[model samples]
Target: MDIGFASSYLRSLFLTSLFSFVAPLLLMGSTIAGLSIISYVPWLGRLSQPGFELVWAFLRTFGNGNALEGSLVIGSTCGLVGALFDTYIFYRQNTFRR
Candidate 1:
């Protein structure tokens, strides 16, 4: 693949990994924040349960809160590694240019 294509692929992988990590943090934060907001609107709060459940499951295994947290940690680590790899690739490509 050309550099552009390769870079795009890499970027997508990076974003996927970033999302894997960030999404959970975002979801967890949202969930906690939602909890506070829900208290104010009892009926709406109940309605939010399904959304929270869906996010939790997507972020974790079987909607387990702890698992979601773990995924966030692991995904962040993987994202870092992927970034470093991308940087190294760029460096090598630039170094080869006249």
Candidate 2:
């Protein structure tokens, strides 16, 4: 493998993993914030109960430490799958170039 290509690929894989790790936290935060704001509306407050319960359940699961392990397993699997897909695309492009 070319050193430059390898380095670039590794960098991309790292970034993909980093994003995969962070994206959920960001999404959860935003979702909670949105729900909090929505709950302030009287009519919508009723609807927010289920959403809050769902988020609470998620947090409760995480609080027990299961979520961390699950997230790691799932995230790594997804990252590896993404890396393999990227690698295949890169290989196909290089092969075509040659």
Candidate 3:
């Protein structure tokens, strides 16, 4: 109930939400960017590399094998999973401290 406790709690919550949103979007964007860039810049493929290949393979197997579909699938799945994981970690930290 004290200011110190409230501030700390809010900080943790903010971090959890921020991380859940940012990390997945970054991953999804990067994956799509990697896929997009391969045609234009072949030599710089090192940046995305095998990770892009793996994701592309997944898209080919499960989805329509297009960039838009891949982006949607990757974004949604990564966001959901990342949110769950971040929430779990946040909950565990709060509970274990008590």
The local distance difference test score of each candidate is 0.66, 0.73, 0.67
Give the clashing pairs for model 1: none
lDDT of 1 by residue, 34-92 (tens): 86677478778777777766655666663355655655665677667766766677677
Better model by lDDT: candidate 2 vs candidate 3: 2
- TM-score of every prediction relative to native: 0.44, 0.64, 0.48
Candidate 3: misplaced stretches above 4 Å? 41-98
- In candidate 3, which residue pairs get closer than 3 Å at backbone N, Cα or C atoms, i.e. clash? none
Whole-model lDDT for model 2 versus the true structure? 0.73
Predicted structure with the largest TM-score when compared to the true one: 2
Instruction: Order candidates by lDDT, high to low.
Output: 2, 3, 1
Best-to-worst order by TM-score is 2, 3, 1
Of the candidates numbered 2 and 3, which has the greater TM-score value? 2
